[model samples]
Target: MTQDTSTRTHCPYCALQCAMHLQPGDDGTLTARPADFPTNRGGLCRKGWTSAEVLTVPDRLTRPLMRKDRNADLVEVDWDTALDHIAERLLTLRAESGPDTVSVFGSGGLTNEKSYTLGKFARLALGTSQIDYNGRFCMSSAAAGSVKAFGLDRGMPFPLTDVGTSEVVLLAGANPAETMPPMMGHLSAPTLIVIDPRRSATAQAALAGGGMHLAPRPGTDLALALGLLHAAHIGGHTDHDYVAARTTDFDRAWEHAAAWWPEHTEQVTGVPATQIRAAADLLGRAAAHRSAYILTGRGTEQHSKGTDTVSAWINLALALGLPGRQGSGYGCITGQGNGQGGREHGQKADQLPGYRKIDDPAARAHVAGVWGVDPDTLPGPGRSAFELLDALGDGGGPRAMLLFGSNPAVSAPDADHVRARIASLDFLVAADFVLSETAAMADVVLPTTQWAEESGTMTNLEGRILRRNRATAPPEGVRTDLEILSALATRLGQPAQRFPTDPDTVLAELGRASSGGAADYSGATPQRLDDGEALYWPVRAGSAPTPRLFLDSFAHPDGRARFQAVEHRPPAEDTDPDYPLLATTGRLMGHYQSGAQTRRVDELTAAEPDAYVEVHPDTAARAGLAHGQWARLTSRRGHTRARVRLTPTARLDTVFVPFHYAGEQAANNLTNPALDPTSRMPEFKVAAVRLEPDPAP
Candidate 1:
C-alpha cells in the first residue's frame, strides 16, 4: 500500500534545520522541496537540496558488520550475532576491568529521544559516568558563558525572527552567509556588524553597505570586545540606570574593560582604532534606540579562552543593558542540527536531561525517580571529550567505547591523534548510516537509519522542536538507532521496560525527566508536533510556547544578570620562530562537518572536491607559494598537506583551512587540543603553524 507520498520534515544538516518536504520517486529515490516552516520559510540551502542523495548512496551500510579478531577485516553479520558479540565483549570488559573501563560517546545530531535514551543507558544500564557528545566541540563555551551570566543557556533567548526587526546586528566570528545562506534574509537590520579575522562572506556584505567589518587579529576578539566597552564607557554611551538596576558586579567589569583603550586594543588586535571607535558608536546608537542584538559563533567560542571571550562580549551587552530588553540581547549561533536540543537532553558530561547539573543531588534524585533507579547509584561527572578520547587505552582509562553519530577521525581536533587513540582501544563500536572514517576503524559498525528513514524530533536554533517524520522505510537490514540501543541494552541484561525502542515511548519519559529543569519540555509531545506548529521549550504542559526569554526578568534568583570581569588572554599556542604562521580551522559551504555524509553526495563533493588552505598574498610570496600549489602545513603537534589558495582575505600571519576531509588533507591534524577551562572547548579556531612549498614533480 506504499505509494509515492510526500512527507514534511526538516533538513538533516545545520541547526537552522530548514523545513522541507520529501517525495519518493519511482526508482525508490527521494527529492526535497522547501516547507513553509517559520524558521526557514520555504528556503533551502545547497546542502538541503542535495541531502537526499545520501539516502541512496551505494556504500550506505545496510547490514551489521563485525571484526571477530583484531586486525581482521570486518565481515557482514546478522543482527543477533552482532548484538550478542558486542554485549558479550562489553560484559567481559566490565568483569575484567571495572564499569569505568567502558565509556559512551554521542553526537549533537541525535534527536531528543535518542539523546535521552543514550544518557539513561550509559548511567542506568552501563553504570558509567564517562559520557559526552561532539557538542563539546560546538557550543559548550556559549553554554558555559550564558549560564554564568543569565543562569541558563538556550542558544537564542529570543527567536530568529527577532533579528529582522532589530535595528543593528553584531555578528561575531559567524559566517552564516556560507554556512547558513538562508539566514542572510534575517540580517535585514539597518546595520550589520561582523567581527572576524578574514573578509568572510558575511563580513564582505557588511563592508559593502550594511554596516562595518572589524577584522581583528586571531585570538584578539576579547581585546576588541573590551575595547568597545571601554569606548562606550568613556563616551558616556552606557545605560547607567539600567546597568545599576538589572546587573551586578558592573564596577569590576568596567575596570577590566577600561584597561584596554582603543589605542592599546588596536595594537593587540591589529584592527585600526578608528574602526573600533566607529563600531562602538554604532552599537551605542543601537542600544540607545533599544533595538540591537549581539550574537556569537564558533569563531568566538572555539578557543582555550572561549568562555572568557564570550563573557567579555556579555559584559559589553550588560553595559549597554541589552540582554533582558525586548528585541535587544545576546545569543549564540549554534552550528549542528540538534546542537540546541542535544545538550538539553543530557548527553553532556556534567548535565542531566533537563540541563541540570549532574552533581546536584536534587537533579540526580529527580532524574533517578523518573528512571526508577536509586539516586545514590547515579555516577558522578566524567572527563570532557578530548580528555576522554586521550584516556583510551591508558593505564586506568576506558578500555571499551561505544560511539554513535559522530566521525571524530575527521571532525575532532587533533583528529590524527584521535584516530590513533581510537585504533588503540580494546574495543570500539560505531553506529552510522555511512562507513565514515571513524567507523572504518571500529571493531563493530551498526547500520542505522538516517533522517528521512527515522521518526523523531529536533530542536532548531530558535529552541523550537520540529518533527522529523518517517518519510519512507529504511533499506532492508538497516535499523533505527533506538532499536539498536534497545537490542544491545536488553542483551546486556537490561529489562525491556527501561530501554524502549519506540520514539514516542522514549519521548514520554524524556518529558517527565526534563520537567522543572532549565530546558523544560513537558508541554511538547509527539502528537502536538505532528498536529501543530513547532513549540519552543520551557513550555510546561498547558502553557504557551516561550518564543522570547528574559522579556521581563532574567533566569537568576534575583531576576538580574551578572557581569563577569574578563580580560583578554593569549591563545593556547602562539606563533613563534618555529611556527611563524597561525592556522585556524573552519568549514566550507559545500561540505558539512567531517564530510561523512555530504562527501558521499556527488554534487557536494564535485563542488568542493579537495581540501585547501587559504593563504594571504604576502604570506604566499614570502613562502614562494603559488595558488593551487600543494603545501605542507606543520604545527607543533603534527602536519597536514593542502592546496594553497592565495587571497588577500587572509591575514599575513594566519592561514585558514577547512576541517572537513580525512587522511592527508585533514585540517584537524594541525589543530590544538588545548581546552577552555570552563567549557572544555578546544582551541579549534586558532593554532600556530608554518607553511612550506611542496615541489610537485
Candidate 2:
C-alpha cells in the first residue's frame, strides 16, 4: 500500500492566512482542507477551499519567454539565455543612464523571505533606490496612522481571538462578512458597529446582532469619527485619568473634535445625528468597561486624505483610552496575505528590513553590516508606488523595471494610465506563476513556483508569524522566486553566497539584518517555527515572543501613545455637474485582488462570472437604467462598463462595484490616482462618476 502524502500549509488568499492541509492524489491532483489554526479556527472560505486549483490552472506559465525585438512576439527561451539578455540590458541601462533609471516593483502576496530578498536584490545587486510594492495601496494609510499614534505599525497588535472577548467591535469601513467569512466567527460574540455607505453584508450582520450600522457618505468617515469623539466626550465617557497617564496631545485633538459635534458631522456624513450619538454611547460605554475594540479597513484608508482619515479614527480610540489595553485597542484589517510582513521586511519605498526607515543612518549601518557592505553604498529613499508607476520610462524616471507578483494593469487605480506607462518602459521583466496582465507586457517573463511549491513564512493579519511548507514539486521549467532572485543577483555581479536560494538560510540572514530594529525577528528561527511555536514579532534572541504590543507602554521614547489632531476634508474628486454619483470599489466573496488567480478557478468563476455595479432603485430610475442592464460609468480618469444590479442596500447617491475583473470591465479604470499626501495611497474608495445606459449591443 502506498503511503498518503500530505503537507500542512496556509491559504494563498487574504491576510487571515487560514491554515490548510494539502493531499496529493494518485492521479496528480491536489485537494485543500482546513486545518486547525488560531486565525481561521479550522474554517476555510470558498476561495481558500479551491486555492489548489490555481496551482494547476490550464494557462499556467512553465517556461521563460522573451520578446526578441520591439514590436515582436514573445518566444520561449532557455533560462540562461533569458537571464543573460536581461542582465546585459540592465547593465547597459545602469551605465548609460544611472542605477535610479531601473526600478523594482514587488507585491504583498510574496512570502517574508521573498520580500526580504527582493529588497536586498534591488539595493545590493541592482544598486537602485527605486523599490516599492502594491501594499502601498492596501493599508499604507493605516500604517502611517498607527505609526504616528503608537510609534509602530502592526495590522493587529493582539491575537484574532481577542475580538471574541470584546463587548463592542467597531468596524469602520470593513466588511469581513463577505471578504473573510471565517473571521465572522469572532464577530459573532461581539456587538458590531459597522460603518459603510452601502448596507453591506457586514452591516446586515450588525443589524442581525442588534448592533448599529452607520451608513455615512463616501469619504466622510473622518467627520463621523470626529463626531463620535465629540459625543463620547460630552457623555463623560472619556477615560480622563487613563488618557492623562498613557497618552499625549489630547488637548489639540479634543479641540478639533469639539467643533465637529453631532449635528455638524451629520450634515457632512449624511448619518443621522441621533445614530451618531447612539453609536458613540455604545463605544464609550464598552471602552469604559475595557471591553471594546476599534478597527479600520481599506474603505476608510484608500482616500486622498487617507492618512488623516485614519488618524481621525485613531484619535477617537485614544480618547477612549483604547491603546495599550488588553481587550480594547485600535487595529487595521490588512488585506493581502503578507501585507503586514511585506512592508516590515523592506519591500516598501522608504523602509529597510525590520521596518526601519531607509533614510536613517543607524538603520543603514545595521542592514549594511549584515550584508557585508558599506552603509554609504546604499541608496536613499525613492518615489512611492504610484509615483514609481507614473514615472516609468519617462525622463529622470525609471527606464527599466523588474516586477513580481503584482498585476498593476488591473489592480492599480487609474489603471489605464498605468498600462500606458508600462507600455512606455524601455525594458521590463516580470516573474510569476502565470502570465498576469502586467507579466504579459514584460520583455522577459520568468515563470516562478506557486505557494504550495515553496516553503516560507508569512505574517498574518494579527502579526503572528506562520510557516507554510512545500506540499509538492513545481512544474518543469519553472523556478522559485528565491532561485530567480539568486540567479539575477549572480548575473549582476553579486557574490553567490550573498544571495542564497534556500528559504531557511535567507530567513536566518533576514533575522540577522533585522536585529535591533523595530520589527526585530532574530529569535524567530526556522527551528522554532518547525517546532510548532506560535511566534509574533520583536522577538529578540533568547526571549519570549510578544503576542500583544503596547500592553504596558507604547514604542515611543516617552512610552505614551500620541493623539493626532486631524480634520475631515472632502475627497480628491467630489460630485459635480458631470458626475453626480459616488462610486466605490471593493472585493467580492469569491474573487480576491485583481482576480488574477481566483478567476482561473472554475468554481469561483461560476459563482461570480462578471463584474457588476450595485445601484439603489431610485438612482437607477433617475439614470434611466434597469436592473441587469449594462451601464457605462465614467470618471475623470477613464470609464468602464458593468451590468447594473438595483438594490435598496445601496445608497441613493452612491454605487458599489467589485474590483476583480480586468479589461473593459475593471472598476479600477475609473478610480482616481490622487494620492494621500502622507501615505501616498490613491483615493480608491471614493470617485466622482456618472452612470449611463450602454447602447452597445
Best-fitting candidate, scored by lDDT: 2
**Candidate 2, 1-697: lDDT as tens digits:** 9775789999998999999999998877789999999889999999999999999999999999999986999899999999999999999999998899899999999999999999999999999999999999998999999999999999899988988899999999899999999999999999999999989999999999999999999989999999999999998999999899999999999889999889999999999999999999999999998999999999889999999989999998988988888999999999999999999998998999999999999999999999999999999999999999999985348999999999999999999999999999999999988888889899999999999998999999998888989999899999999999999999999999999999999999999999998898899898999998889988888889898999889999999999998988888889998999999999889999999999999999999998999999999998999999999999999989899899987888999999999998999999999999999999999999999998777
Q: Which stretches of candidate 2 lie over 4 Å from their true place?
A: 1-4
Worst 10 residues of 2 by lDDT: 390-399
Error of 1 at 115 (Å): 0.5
Candidates' lDDT values, in order?
0.89, 0.93
State every prediction's TM-score relative to the real structure: 0.98, 0.99
- Candidate 2 similarity to native, TM-score: 0.99
